[model samples]
Target: MEPLGAGDPIRLGPYRILGVLGAGGMGKVYFGRDNTGRTAAVKVLLPELAHDPHLAQRFLREAHTAQAVTSGGVARVLDARIDGDDSRPWIATEFLSGPTLDDAVRAYGPFGADGVRALAASLAATLSDIHAAGLVHRDLKPPNIVLTATGPRVIDFGIARPEHGMTLTTTGQVPVTPGYGAPEQVLGQRVGPAADVFSLGAVLAYAATGRRTFDGTHVAAVQYEVVHGEPRLDDVPAELRHLISPCLAKDPAHRPTPEQIAGAFAPPQGADRIWRTGPLAKDIARRGAEAARQATLVGREPGSGPSRRRLLRASLAAGAVVAAGGGAGAWWLLREEPRTPVESGLASGAKLLPRSTAQSGKAPKPLWGPLPVAAKPVDGLVPAPLSLRDVVVFAAKDGGLAAHFTRDGKEKWRLPDVTPAAGLHPLTEQLFAAAGTSGALRVHDASTAKLQWELPDADVGRFLTMDDENLYAVTRGGQLLAVDLTMQSIRWTKPLPTYAVRGAGPRAAVAGVTLVLFGDDGAVRAFSTIRGLDMWTIEGQGKSGSAIAPAVVKRKDSNGTSYTVFLGGRTLKALKFPGGNEVWKAGPPQNGTDSWGAPLVHGDTVIATNGTTLAAYDLDGRQLPLNGRAARGPLPATPLVRQGEALWAVEADGRGVSAYSTTDGARLWTWSAESRGPWGMSGAGNRVFLVNDGKLTAMPTVG
Candidate 1:
């Protein structure tokens, strides 16, 4: 170990500086030997930066908050203080004896599943420690992730602090480090643990693959792309792709928390990879030897046919590995033939390659895998962790996103009184419902957790969107219900699609007094939800039961063209509403996987995310950034796009809530995880709410 400098005897805070470890955009970290000659890494804000309020304050806040965390993952805080000198603000932590993640990746190449597991476990443990201290590590990237002799240690708490009183506009400029930062960080919104989880996902990806997620040549361009791009998952390993999606979501509300990320990554399935196995090859050998003994039945025989048979059976039983609830397990029995540890994986049931210690053709490192691409069905995609401040509207299972709340794991309200049972709708807040459930046009008070009123229940919960004025809902039985909230609920019900009620998305919409509904066979019926009269009808375009996008009607063009947008998988189409004529259809929003995150539309730009990337295009089918990598999300929920200081979004990944920027697609923040995203994202108005199969939770954001 090389000492920093000639062991300069410099005194700063509560310790004496002996050498310098490293420096970055934040400040200089020194290898300081305390009065007891104990080496410690003391980080101090650069003199020039110390003069800036945000830099200095954040630096001290990070130290103060980090010091409160007393976890094995955390470097012990020997001593710290904001001394009298204006140019010296520093904190001293015990010197860590490990390689930085950057170094690890450079030295050993990409990490495989084992490395990922170990890294996750260490990080989760660190986040757990930090959370316990009521602090959050706003910037958690690979460079900041360190692998010490003791275990994995998270360093550089320069930006780690309570999520309060912070803004994304630095010097009133947009947030920095676009791709790594979340929307909240971009928008200057208050952040929490979810931000760390998002960062964990990015860092983990970098650890496994040697590339930065939002990597591009230009910083602003990278920022633009990350805030709105998708992950190139075809490059990612299939086994771990599912794990990365949740952490890279655009919505801070949907990204998993550190705990969730940790739990998912450190669980029994792939978690063993995260364990600090000093000698991986030796450990596998030990396990293999035990297996060999079991196959031979030990004392029973030496070179007996029975032993060979058992050994063969044992080898066959090894099969391929799969991800279990929270750990790694065999998915199927491929060749399982006990070859001399030299052959390539017996290409049978292996989900990922078998663990090996050979040189050439060696399986990718444990944590290393291809990047996550668009969503595709993996073993199973679990839910993300939820904070208490997001807004979760209900659909299907109950009603049109009825307002819900929770606290200390208890629901404050779960009322369907807002509207009738509306089929699940995303990217739009307007509520609609179906019959049997409640064909009523239920309007909800998002703030009060109460229903303002319900229109009718005849249409079932079919169409629940708005076009300036009226509300519409249709049932599978071809019954259309509509009501104008501006006026009294005089209610208008129409009947159509008497046969197959297949296609639902992009089905019903209302403009002025015009109502439209599409059927299973692509048939369209245009009528008046306000007056119960037919305007027009036409054939549809997609397969029955395909994801039916909500119908959107816009103003008429010079050619008397009235455009409406509809989505089916990756395809986005524009059609003439009322007239039912195809205008133009763009590509689908997603390709290989499910579009877990919501598809958002803002004016002329239609924004959506695939499994690993976010994309934008004009309604006319033109690419926005046909030039850069995209921000990504297959996280399981719609994101909240708050256009404030910068564009911000919060949504659910399979593992936790996360924040991101909509302006350029930068991830501004994240929270680490110990939970999954099934706890659907919810809440608004000063609080966030989340619910899983078991519990309803509420967390305060503003109040």
Candidate 2:
């Protein structure tokens, strides 16, 4: 860690650079704090190299690669500026407070068998997640692995590329660390997920015995040993030799897969405590606390002076162990900042939402107000609120749609001519698609309410759903249309079945290449997004009066990636997407005639209300207990929403909301409001927005 020298940027994007953590060949990593006081390791490209297109592309690629893997075993990317421009590109990653594997091993001795097994299993799981996202981490070594309170997190994806990508390097440069890189990577050959497995073997061997699997005095000798020479495993334990030796196999094809490594090294129960309970944990905690205290001092004394600079430098130095060991894996202290009102037109990019610290066991007061923002429609159906960045868009009280800042109940903008019945759907973070009174398809900038584009003859009566390429809508004449967003033209239109268009527009959801629709007649249909071709249809999917909302999710199983649609009605069912085949089905509560309402999918759990009881099930149709008594009042047909650790749903009375723990399904608290009939609920930015009888209220979520 060092003081900011001449020519260093004071700020990049939303982050304020406090001090420089370290410098590498391509750029420098800085300790940065955002306006919200969230900390990050902001990596900036060297100004001299910013104009190098190749370096710039690789910098941006690192950001994308790190963001692709969604696992707790990796440092989360907070924000990045990858757009090619005159400004220097930078990436902000959550600062992890921990010592690097190398530092820990140097301070303490080599890990015991239990510790080694735990490390192997955790790293293997992270590798599996990386491979699942179609990437191969080319560098897996001690310095890049951080030991945190939770577990070992793999960091530094600087050279990670697609599984099928060939080894890329500049002239005279090796792409991987000498002792840890696979033989294929050493020979500059094409690599795949197996390459990461080879690196994992080396990492585990080093962890078990403070020695590398392949080592030599010179870099060339180490490379030679990796490609053709036998590994030196004399120091490795006898029981672990067989497992570690196979990983160092000369041929990539002969190496064990990550799953095999994890299963073979299955650590005993309570193995994770190895990191949480040892001296290593104390070291990590001390560094984190000192860094946190210094951050507070710097925040309290924002004035620029020698004393402030010295304090900032000390803070960065205290956290240098994290920066040195984990490279870009360091993160700021995890603490909540004060919630402030949002400025108009500002996008909530990578910003943590303001959360309420209220206990879930008691009712929480409204964060904002039960303002009259929605209109009491003649049909008694209130449109569900939609969140775009910082604003929550809803059906305006007077007419059309209105966008309100989530921080406060202040109205940001409104579109009086936009038809709420036609639907308001976000096209992107900055733009949204809506239907006009004349059935015209229109797109507007979300922040300014400025119209970006429109098609007068699109004849979109109701917006069903949208994807990256097109918007799916329906016409008053019962025709389904796919509007090509890029071309601003109609891609395809097909007449819906006569029974599919009765009452309000068909409830819809998009699953990969398929568009699923639940007709008023309780029938479900799937259509191809490329062309309006019928894929499959299921009859009698819902009960007579049940809301036919279809929840779609993509799940990976033994057969690979497959989309499954969940529906409520005559029975709760999971149907294979596009094919419309029954995957699993569960009957309503035994000995009762109450049918299932719309289902909600969160991770592996699918939740829905059956009569007065709330039930949860795995995707395979196994029931799980909610731990609390079922709702005594009538549960509505709306889908359940998850925020923080609780699942929220419209209460049985149709005028209140209930919170239940997603872990055990125990009812937390109930919020009641006076309302006539239909109620709509949506959650975003750590706040739950509810609309009942034309009144909109914002409530805080448990932190």
Query: lDDT: which candidate is best?
Result: 2
User: For every model shown, what is its TM-score relative to the native structure?
Assistant: 0.38, 0.53
lDDT of candidate 2?
0.74
Top TM-score model: 2
lDDT of 2 by residue, 1-703 (tens): 4567788887788777767777766777877777777777888888898988888887878889999999899988888885334478888888777777765664444677888889999999999999999899888887788887788988888778888787857565566777888888888888998888888888888777666767666778778888888888887888888988888787778988889999999999988776888567776776676556545545443455434323423322323334332334332211112112224333221111223333435677787789977877546667788876557888999998998876577889888898888767776435678889989998887667888779898998777887646788888778999987646789899989767776664888888788988887778788999898998877877644344678888787798888888888778888886577788998854436456778988878888877666788988889888654445465767777777667788876575788877767777778877665778788765567898888888876654
Off by over 4 Å in 2: 1-361, 589-594, 627-632
Q: Number of clashes in every candidate structure?
A: 155, 7
In candidate 1, stretches whose alpha carbon ends up further than 4 angstroms from where it belongs are 1-9, 23-27, 45-58, 82-87, 173-178, 267-703
Cα lDDT computed for each candidate against the true fold: 0.47, 0.74
**Candidate 2, residue 484: how far the Cα is off, in Å:** 1.8
Tens-digit lDDT string for candidate 1 (1-703)? 1123342325675464433444545566654444444555566766777678876676666667767777887666666666535666777676544445654454334667767777777787788778777887776665455554455667656456665637443466543344566656655678877777777777777667656666555555565655678865555567778988887787877877667766677645544443245333333333334333332241242244333222222222111110000000110001111112111111111122221221122212212111121122112321222221222334313332333322122223355433322343321222222223434444443323444444453445455454433456555455665554434253566665555354334355554455655455545556764477877655444344433334464666677646564443335455555555667665543545543233456667766554455566677767676211223345332443432212223333444344334455545443323444343343332233344333334332210
